[model samples]
Target: MPLDQIPDEKEMSFLDHLEELRWHIIRSLIAIVVIAIAAFAMKDFVIGTVILGPSRTDFWTYQKLCQLADLIGTPALCIDSLTFELVSRKLSSQFMTHVSVSFVVGLVLGFPYLFWEIWRFIKPGLRPQERKASRGATFSVSVLFMMGVLFGYFMIAPISVRFFSTYQVDPSLQNLFDLSSYINTVTLIIFGCGILFQLPVIVYFLTKAGIVSSALMKAYRKHSIIVILILGAIVTPPDPFSQILIALPLMMLYQFSIVIAKRIEKREARQNKES
Candidate 1:
């Protein structure tokens, strides 16, 4: 086996494998760069509409909450009036935050392509049946990640913002946030949510490997909820309302993972019985 020969589908030596992986990584980086450039160009929209969206009273989520409140006749559900000021103390803070947020936006937008590139590299190593078993994995993961990000941004982040901005130790004290701090907090929340949303996928694979089962998850349901609550508290501000907001969706995801694990277990049982 020589080191020079590698043409997509042919057997590759160690060096050839490294070369292939390098190319895949290069392509993925290029995609992320292109997306970052696009995001950088749309600076005003990205900063004004997205990064600061949750901090505003008239944001879409708040408006929807108001409407829901009116419908349910619960005037208290109408979320409004965040009192806070975002300030940048350092000279380059704003520029640095702009670049950082743009890069994050790029990654979020290009997540599917980035993951596809990675899966392309890994898929070749798996057997045909194994690959077939994970058919649509890229799509499912990307969609769930986006859904979680949206939920965090539109729901959890806003609630946290509202709570912290409104909470007061004294009437004279004001809530002032650093520009970087605010953006970083929101970005981390969304990212954390995206990772948390992979519960079902993780459960599926663990079930397939016989490392986890529906019964085990059911037995530890209370523990899982407590963990989810802790995770919510870690990602969100130290407020019960915000913690509850993030925890609710995770609780649902956990329950859904149990169902997924159950189905997979039953299918395996049937297959083994037939054999």
Candidate 2:
């Protein structure tokens, strides 16, 4: 090896590849840490307004529902309050929750940058044709991921919080939610839905790799819907409305994935014919 010479990717050893990946991971961590510090600094706003919003009756989602309730003459649709008492049993619980929530906020906000770094590492390993097929992948994946996060935040979190907070098996029963558990549940739901929204991107690559096709997806449409509904039930409160809310978007995503697979199939067919 020549001194001060850059080695070709193909010439790089496994350790060299690992070193490059380590740097990418470090940079991604730095981005998340930076965001986390900022979130930690804004403790009141991040915790009170963002994390606790869904747990309050005055959240934007609840306000919108109240308006819809008025318009539809359905007073029951208006969520006036959350009946649960959120308590921190441990003396350090609040402080620990703040730190953990800050990190989660960082992860959510820094997701695009983190994924971009991973993509950079992976892109060089992909074939040129594969690279071309996945152009704008970073942007598409980031957008879809954020959309899912937002949808889960606005659509699922509030409803689930309200339902669980208010639901009672007996009049003597009380709902006392742990502060950390409540916040963690909200963050987990958002992150889970964000990951789920990568279905289209996953399908596109799978289609290109010939492991999946539009025909298979279309054939399994009913099965997919059943699975999505089950997922919605699992992630959301066991209410039909909450389940429907999550299921509707996931169903749409599955349909969109089918379209994406079909397009890939068509493009490959055309290329084969031309060649």
Candidate 3:
């Protein structure tokens, strides 16, 4: 519907607005549930191929790491084996895990459509300029989310699995990981990264709201680096190399957020001058 056809927020009561929001949320949930059901139908493939891929030495990430090690003359980076086996202790553990994983997959896959519904609900409340300013918000958010997911899967997840699976307190002790524990680690890492990758979008909104400014971000550059380093250490393996790897991209994102903030400031300044 066009902006002119849509009823203004002033025309609707609080209950009417709430009802509209409820329907949007309901639609989003329905999309997620439908996708989840479809994912559940392919539980075997999702669990075997995608979920367990990082634990295997023959996985793409491992292979690439090994190749990089060969080029650098460091065989230590070549992960030849993972020293853990995943086990289910309870009878219904596998079935429950399957359902949970399917739901998570559904949420990830249906995120774009879900956000589109949210945007539709919010669009009518925004002025024409605000709507125009956020023209590509949904697309940008979705792309960043997927990029983060892929980064976690290909870079962070494999390295973390390899490290945790191989690290041992005693040579005689064997690593026997629970199935739920493994899945939780993978999902958390992927989703965490996805959230982190929305830095630019978050900054845009904050800047537009006059809560955050480019000057503030620039002034806090050193402190931000420290925070990013801490975050990298928290997310990745407890090693300098792994921490550095995660920190680099995060720092880049911070810098990119600053640039985004600057653009928003300039745009708003121009609009103010015109008015």
Q: Which of 1 and 2 is the better model by TM-score?
A: 2
Candidate 3's error at 234, in angstroms? Answer: 5.1
Better of 1 and 2 by lDDT: 2
> What C-alpha lDDT do the candidate models reach, one value each?
0.87, 0.89, 0.87
Root-mean-square deviation per candidate = 2.8, 2.6, 2.2
Candidate 1 weakest ten by summed lDDT: 1-10
Taking the candidates one at a time, how many backbone clashes does each contain?
0, 0, 0
Q: For candidate 3, lDDT tens digit of each residue in 6-89?
A: 656448768777888888888899999999999999877898999999988889999988999999999998998898999999
| Model 1 residue 236 CA deviation in Å | 1.5
Model 3 residue runs over 4 Å out of place are: 1-5, 233-242
lDDT of 1 by residue, 153-190 (tens): 99888988888788899999989999999998899898
